[model samples]
Target chain A: MSTCKTAIRISAKAPRITILPLIQRRHESSARRHKKLLHLPQAPSYAPDRSAPSLIFNPPSSSPNVYHTPLKFLPKDDKRRTLYQTALNLSTHAALRRSTSAIATSGTPLTTSSHLPPRPSATLPPPVRAPYEKKYHLADKEIEEIRRLRLSDPDKWTRARLAEKFGCSQFFVGLVVKSHEKAERVEAEHERMRTRWGARRRAAREDRSRRKEMWGRDE
Target chain B: MKRIRIARCGTQLLAPPSPRRPLCPHVVRFQKTITLHNYRIQSRLQSTAAAREASNFEIESIVEEVESSANDFPSSTWTSPRHTPLELLPSPHPSAALKSAKLAALRSRLSLPPRFPLQTLARTLIHPSADPDPTFNNGSLSILGANLLGYYTTEHILCNYPRLPMSVVFAAQWAYIGPKALATVASEWGIEAAAEPGGEIDPGLLQFKRLRSGDDLPTLLKGKQAPWKWNVTMTNKILKSDEFGSTASRPDAQQLQGMPVPIEEAAQSFVRALIGSLYLHLGRPLTKRFFRDHFLSRHLDMDKLFDFRTPTRDLSRLCAREGFEAPVARLISETGRHSNHPVFIVGVYSGKDKLGEGAGSSLNEARIRAAAAALKAWYLYKPLEVTVPSSTEGEVDTSKWKPNMVDCGEVIV
Candidate 1:
């Protein structure tokens, strides 16, 4: 038989239905994962696997996109992948609290939940319809704070605490934190640059001596 | 202008009606059909870009005719062959304006590197009859069971290449294809290949790069994460190259055994195999380590290296440790060439220290020379009567043997 037809018509006569609904579906899934962030640390008790002979820790699952922040630091090794996921989970919790508190501190206790007490209008920040973005956007310094709490914390911040502090759903906070080799490399590079800067004063003196000697010889 | 620019920036939000056509020409011809197609396309694109808030399709694709028409003219939204306007559904979203902004920002932040290209071995397999490698009996592995010298040798060869599993190139060649196929190959044998490469090597691998540094546990172990514990703390501690010249030495010294062939002369095939596996792993040919005339050359005959076990002895225990079986441990023990073990070279047990022993590199080399000394011991201590006490008078007194040149043919197997 001859080869099958090469030209496959991708879109029907109508394209919008195919496009917009798909995006909406994806955002809804992301929102599901984001909403779950609030429940992570105290998330329903450890349900044992009936089939397993022993207690095995199940990897906490999230929307696959949750790893976007954490996996960047790890190599391809599985242990690294797990470590990265753990770190991301930690940060996601912290980031949620951070984001919420910042929004709250600005006097907008924008708790979408009806269960939360009504805020005093006098204490509230101006209700600017910042389109859910400017209010949620992470600042560079705040990003640094979240990163430090996740990476350098002695007790290793738990998922719940992170969520509570960052004002995010605990699950979203968990996603915001992660560890990686690339991060290590970045840290190393930063140190190297700092060391170079530290040596500049000594080099300047040595250069001055050489220049003076050259001037004397010319005279 | 602002609306057009927003649409332009979020190009992926709509698939541009082929660059061949004006914006949404199909809308006029079949308006309802076009609208249906746009919604379907968005879901497909969303699946791939689920992880990212905004992907290339969301940012760069052109607006589909149906969605655009609906958004632009909400009054004329539906057509079920009867021109009744569909109720304006809540623009199904966090709103298009928010999406457009997120897509634009995420697009700027995105960057990904290109992956490694396929190499010669891959290219050869894809195009049959590409090289001298005979396809005949390409799969048959006869009689060779556990502890077979040939099997170990082939494994040791591939161990030199860091990432390649032996089965990847040999057993179910599909291993190089991907993780799923590789997992299948491993499961068939009831062996789950480690998620990460064990990253160890053959004992003879003097040139391997240590990914980390280790000041302790001896440089031979090279701080490799043990397949057992996989402790990350023990990273890349390598031995200095200069020290390699002093420590690596040959096993035997005295006389060549068997056909009196040079050890190096016999080891050509082994060396070829070694180089071939290295070529496969490193993506580069083994040149510097192969052609060296240094101490390594002076000690072990790369030629006599007919088995993998020979190199396995000099190399560290960690080197032989592949994913599952530690094959080198068995091969090293079976050779029976160490002085501690006895072999076929018959000689009296007179223990005179041999010459090569003094110049040998490791104790393995010293022991090898001691065995050769055993060969000479048999001749030197041959006890006999002083005057040839032959019971039969007719027997010629030729019983007393005379001296001949002391020679033990090449010792390689």
Candidate 2:
């Protein structure tokens, strides 16, 4: 047992340099040094201006913090309220300074003098398809004809096909037409498909439906 | 006059002509009437003794007030027989409150003032089921107390967290002073229930007809259909439902008379009646103090009550409504992206300011969590100084009053 202990000690102290070469160690140290050198500059100071007479324009964030008291909730005479406002002003000033410098270098003319940037011109992004406007041009006789045709050939003149023929949305086509037989046939087909599902698949489907019900509860 | 004449004629026929007095007609008539009255009293006493002997229950004699002329007889003779036993009374008599040690202990344990009568306390313990009579039971007082509790709780919640969603507000109310919560409070106060409710039971013990095991719930206590078949709107709930925002209305205490009720129902009713009786006896200020100490002091996490779906969408909508910049979720940091348990820290930002930050295993989960946190912060905003509307009630001085801010309500998605 004494010999075994000495042997273990000897092996434990074996030179680790053979496993990790000197060159690799040098490279690792250099990589750490490079990382240190790549550190970003410090953020601008947000010290409050003690001489400022009026409250600053710092707005509260939606951040959830038990200790944080929003400016709106703060008492009118609270000392922290003024300090928070001044800090926000200093930060915004720093941001404005950075943005102005970028614009100057880019040679883009600054049009507005407001603190915040101008809002985007369009409320929504560009549509994937051609923008369709409601015309309200379908006559009562035409709507009746569309409904009659949809009822006659329930499978052929489907919602999509009817919508295409009438130059209207599928939703509008559905509102104008109804076929109880088609609905029943579709439901029966879905039911037959569901019956064919194995135990695992059936359980998974049931679990999915249960999870869907919990969505409204935000579980 | 006819009765007197008949008695006189009978007395004269029965008695031989009174030769000892040689009395006039008027004298004879008077003498005969007095004798007849005495005979009638004797027969009534005999019948009462026989009736008392026949009954198994003890009969107590209650004094009856007699006219001054009739008071010439002994006071004991004027006593009327009471057939009903004391135990047979529906509820305990008010005078019994003084004799109950449990009641005295309860009064002292509650730190109630000496001026607060034990009779009222005893009455509060008698649930409508135990004593169907409204005058004896706590039914009316419980109704008054229920209203007061709802009013106080509503004002407190509204004042403290003005921006809580309607559903969440209802949940908070339920958490604080709902039937279950009140029942828990009663048990915490060391209230014990009687084995069976009767006039013979201790006045301190909660008295309600116990629903036998395996017995079905009473019709009034059973769950009822919602006012609407589908889509029970918040407005409808606010207007039509109880304080807890339940679709089915609360069961009327009077309707549950003589019906067996669960222990929880009885306990809650006792608590409400106590509060109502306190308000009546001790006035507003003391009742408010009692409420603050007992009900308000309970620990309920307001944050846990909120259950949000589509929090991200809700946050964006809230920002738009409040004229703030649209929220954008940005990944702040990540670890072990390729590993089984990858963690992502995400921050939701509105323009230059970061709204909220959350860490989760998946980026989407983190973003959703961050949005939820932001929404929670907005809803849970508490003012440094708040004075509820109830605080100003019945106050002569208005100098310390500060108007509360009523928010435009929660964000709708």
Candidate 3:
């Protein structure tokens, strides 16, 4: 019975060898190379170099930023005024050295360093409108005339119309002239509107003002 | 003296009893010895009674005895010291200072000099509410201490950050030496309060009539004006308000006598009284050191105190006032423009120089933050090597003093 079973197993395996040629086989070395390419190198440790200078590279957490101080804020006699400039120079020099070394070894110069960025030569987008300029053309007389126009017929000479007439911004017109009656009327109207507000709306509005007040306190 | 007079009156009334007891000479000697023993005990009781009574009649008799014996002795021979019991006194006696281990521990804990008498230290613990008498209570010392604290804190803040706005200045002052801050400082010093203030209580413990639980706040502490009616201007606050710039004035310590006060009030009073007594005992230099170590050493971020509503407008107004180029916000960098969480970094620049930078989730928020940062930078500028006005208060030499820069005041918008 054992011999019969052995013969049957051998017959089952004999037909499986003939199916090998039907499948294409790749080179084992190519497969090995593909596996090697996918394998990643271990990440570099963040520990500081033992031979590096003791100058602080990374400050403790929650520490204030060193660059928060603006140059204008520094007094003329302050040592920190020159310290920042020296640091900037040193950082730039270090970046140059790193870039040069990289270029020598890899044939490609590094574009940026960790600390110093390349100086911004490109013009920044204008903060205000391109055509906007402060015009000193509006004299005291013009201001007086604007005030008179607003005082005589506030409804007719609204801020927009006055600004258009003087070729100035409505902000300037508002600054030059104010209507107390209009303010009082608006305040009364707002009060009337507030009286109609339900409890939830009133609470929300009150909370908003309270929040606004807390802003100055940085609450 | 009153007890002695009563004893003499009883002896006169019961003289027949003394005559009946003299039957035998030997027995008489025994009776004499017994009478002497009884007299010794009576004298002891009399001394205690005299100490307890502390009456004007006893004082007059002593003075009369001294007057009658003036020719017999040049120096004071009569020394009948009277000590009132602790329970009878309103506050603890100065002599009790030596017996208090807590007071001694507190002294050593504070590192005070041996010369800083514990008696004064003990007096400082007695709040006006506990002891109504000005002589025993901490009321006067607290007033003095409050003034000194205000002066020190004001000079420090004003000199360190010269350009701080009035509101910020008031807030910073409040943050440093306000009632709440002082109370916190007191508690941090490991001060323990007495269950109930009394003369018999330990001198080391803070003595104040504590407000009962669930009791309504004192009327003095409650808001005096309606919330909507309150419209105190900054100028008015500076001129008329307390150091914290509150519209309501601080209540007098004496006015709270026998009334229950909140722990904060009592703790603040104790701290102030401590400062005042330290000033008197140790002088200005050491007191200044104490202030620096205890109060100024605490961390307070000046930047966090600012709450800017219209930073962009304020910055422009500041620029116009200072004769600088108008501040303009420019985008420095941005990422994830089309993503759910976009970040934009904006810098506020006056001309070629950047004043401040801030990063926020959106362009408008970043711009506003940048403006606020710029305003803060302008306000929080600290001059190096600042000499507070108080430092040179008593110095005769004026050569080393450099006058601090007084800014044209904060930007009004």
Best by DockQ: 3
Instruction: Tell me which of candidates 2 and 3 scores higher on TM-score.
Output: 3
Instruction: Record all residue pairs in model 3 with backbone atoms less than 3 Å apart, i.e. clashing.
Output: A215-B307, A216-B307
Candidate 2 local lDDT, B255-343, one digit each (tens): 99889999999999999999998887777899999999999999888877777778888988988887777777777777999999998
- Per-candidate iRMS values, in order, are 36.0, 7.8, 4.0
Chain A only: give the TM-score of model 2. Answer: 0.50
> B333 in model 1: Cα distance from truth in Å?
12
lDDT of each: 0.29, 0.72, 0.73
lDDT of 1 by residue, B1-413 (tens): 23333333223222333322335554444434444435433433343223333223332344463445434443233223222111221111112223333223322322101111111111111101111112111011111111122233333223322222222223221122122332332233232111111112111111111233332323322222336554322112113211011122222211111112211222221223222322233322222232222112323221121222232222222212312222111111112445665332111111121111111222333333322222212112211122212122244655553322222321222
Candidate 3 runs further than 4 Å off = A1-67, A75-79, A93-98, A101-131, A136-166, A176-219, B1-85, B220-231, B393-400
Docking tier of model 1: it is: incorrect
Q: How do all the candidates rank in terms of lDDT, highest first?
A: 3, 2, 1
DockQ-sorted candidate list, best first:
3, 2, 1
Q: Which ranges in model 1 have alpha carbons more than 4 Å from their true place?
A: A1-219, B1-19, B22-75, B78-111, B114-169, B172-413
Clashing pairs in 2: none
Candidate 1 chain B lDDT trough over 10 residues, lowest sum: B137-146
Local lDDT at A124 for model 1: 26
Restricting to chain A, the TM-score for each candidate equals 0.20, 0.50, 0.58
* Candidate 1 Cα lDDT to native: 0.29
